[model samples]
Target: MVDRLEQSKALASQARLSVLGWLADPQAHFAHQVTGPPAEIGVCVTLLAARLEMAQPTVSRHLEVLRRAGFVTVRRIGKWAYFQRNEAALADYKAWINDHL
Candidate 1:
């Protein structure tokens, strides 16, 4: 209960919300990768950092927050980390929001 409230509060940041929006439509928000499309796996941290116009470390910290909030999921392909939205988690979050507030 209290923990859920705390988790919800953690996602209140503008940066985290923006990250979720980009992830919502990876193909639309992100560009195609040399290896493949962002939709195939997930958007790479480098691309996300570039799009956000923030330092890699800063973007990474935002991603970490989203990941902890269950709004994003991470996959590592070699040295790079890719991120995708967790639709189920988002749906759950939405429901929680509706119920709580």
Candidate 2:
């Protein structure tokens, strides 16, 4: 069904930009962060960049991509920008795609 295909495509889009991928690969992308959550903690851009050994601007670009794809939500806390998994949105997207596709 066209609808099903659309649903799958939407989720695929999200997965392509998942913050989960970064969280899943903490050693690779989470090492450089100064003070960040563990695997149990949500990944933040600054921490992620530190872990990834990348520049803040670069990490921000990646985070922006994920945020746009509906994979993560960014909230500014004081002077820090915290990124969290959009679990509810992701779950809803998965369920819709599963039901339709």
- lDDT string, candidate 2, 1-101, tens digits: 12444434444544334546666565566655555644444556666666566788977876776666565677775677777677776677778758866
* Candidate 2 regions with alpha-carbon error over 4 angstroms: 1-18, 22-42
Clashing pairs in 2: 30-51, 31-51, 32-50, 32-51, 33-50, 33-51
Q: What are the per-residue Cα lDDT tens digits for candidate 1 across 3-101?
A: 576567668788778878888888888766665578878999988899888999999988887787777899998998999998988888788779978
TM-score of 1: 0.89
- The TM-score values for the models, in the order shown, are 0.89, 0.56
Leading candidate by TM-score: 1
Among all windows of ten consecutive residues in candidate 2, which has the lowest summed lDDT?
Answer: 1-10
**lDDT of all predictions, in order shown?**
0.82, 0.61
